[model samples]
Target: MSRPPLPPFTRDTAIQKVRMAEDAWNSRDPARVALAYTEDSRWRNRSEFVVGRAAIVAFLTRKWEKEHDYRLIKDLWAFDGNRIAVRFQYEWHDAAGQWHRSYGNEQWEFDDAGLMRRREASINDVAIRESERRFHWAAPGPRPADVAGLGDTPE
Candidate 1:
């Protein structure tokens, strides 16, 4: 199955792709999110190396289990040919109720079919108090239209 906004992306399409990904991740459904990648997709998320959709699903399952009430935002950083780059932030609390915000940059390479074949991400986390949270939208949902993006502030 081919995903839309296929490669050789324009500015608008790249932005659309980024938002689509952000929305899918916000859903926190591992199986649903795995469909966006190729069957043999490869990923480097932080220090972990994962390959294939099944592995992706397993990885996400473990992740969401530990990251309670996760919310995410992704901004398109650049795109060319079949590749796109993104900068993202996400907030989640551990089982112990300590909140942490993660900042990351991802490089994605998609096949002609628009399924991501390779992904590389580098991320860092900073602990924050509950009151310091910037993303206040409901969990497992898209950011509201009224909510500002990373570009809106110097944070």
Candidate 2:
């Protein structure tokens, strides 16, 4: 049965979870990343909406497959009770060798258990030449940090 939508968007845990999600996406391993959500996490990414972990995996697989050299970096936007907003951009080369920089935003809702209950995203892409591209979608994180960009924390 379908359930009600999220109540509100505010919480510290949710913010941390969002950061973890950003880290996973920047990892570039969709398989590993998919595990973060509930087994039945519901998501609306751009135009496609998917449910369950298997679907999330499949969706990510197809996405990374066509969007080669995929690199994603997400920055914290805002936070509320159990939701967080994010602004992110990724650069990827399509199968036809066309490079695109996709700018997007997302609103994430979490259950009491802190697992993502719902996700809604919007994206728009702009084409760019290889030389003009900066975020090559290649990194352990978004950037090297020293250059004043986002990067993974040292463990």
Candidate 3:
């Protein structure tokens, strides 16, 4: 099955793809999110290496379990041919109620079918008080239309 907005992305399509990914991730459903990748997809998220859709599911499962009340935003940085770059930030609290915001950049390479075949992400985490959180929308849902993207402010 081919995902829409297939390769050789233009500005609009790239932004759509980014928002689609952001929405899926905000759902916090590992199985649901894994469908965006190829069966043999490979990923390097932070320091961990994961391969295949199953591994992607497992990795995300472990991640969401630890990252309580997760909320995320992704902005399209660039795109050309079958590759896209994204910059993102997410906020979540640990089991101990310590809130943290993560900043990252991801480079994605998609197959002709539009499924991501390879992904590389580099991320850093900064601890913050709950009151400092910028993402105030409900959890496991898309950011509201009224909410601004990272481009709106320096944060």
Candidate 4:
């Protein structure tokens, strides 16, 4: 059976949800990240579609396996009623020590229960040097409360 009607998506809630999702992803725990989505969550990251939490888990597992030392930072782009759009930049190094930075945008749709039901994203990848890195959130502590909108803040 198909999923039910989507909830009233708004900018605020969407940003909040995106924050939690980012946290989970940055944690690099596939299972934890999958839990934020609906059981049948559907997603397209750079054109590949993966449905359901199981697939999300598996996809993330395979993703992290190939991407070592992954770190991500997502910024809020815009938000309507029930949908929130985001622009993000991430850094990761491969097993061979090749550093890369990816720029992307994501659109998210949430269900009534507050679980994300659908996500669409487009990303562009480029190789970069270690000195070009931006997110230096290194001194390990709690992440900012509002990471999505923390554009140039000390976050």
TM-score per candidate, chains pooled:
0.98, 0.79, 0.98, 0.83
> Relative to the unseen true structure, what is the C-alpha lDDT of residue 115 in candidate 2, on a scale of 0 to 100?
65
Q: How many residue pairs clash in all the candidates, one count each?
A: 0, 7, 0, 4
Instruction: Show where candidate 3 strays beyond 4 Å.
Output: none
lDDT of 2 by residue, 1-155 (tens): 21223335445544456557866777767787776677788999988989988998899888888888776667668887777888777778898999998888898877765667688999999998988676643464644344323334211
List runs of model 2 lying over 4 Å from the truth: 1-15, 136-143, 147-155
Candidate 4 segments exceeding 4 Å error: 1-11, 138-150, 153-155
- How does model 2 score by TM-score? 0.79
What lDDT does the true structure give each of the candidates?
Answer: 0.95, 0.72, 0.95, 0.75
Stronger candidate by TM-score (1 vs 2): 1
- Per-residue lDDT of candidate 4, residues 27-112 (tens digit): 88889788778898899988789999999999999989987777787777887655778888777888999888888899987766
Q: Looking at candidate 1, what is the lDDT of residue 40? A: 100
Worst lDDT window (10 residues) for model 2?
A: 146-155
Error of 4 at 135 (Å): 1.6
Mark the regions of model 1 whose C-alpha exceeds 4 Å error after superposition: none
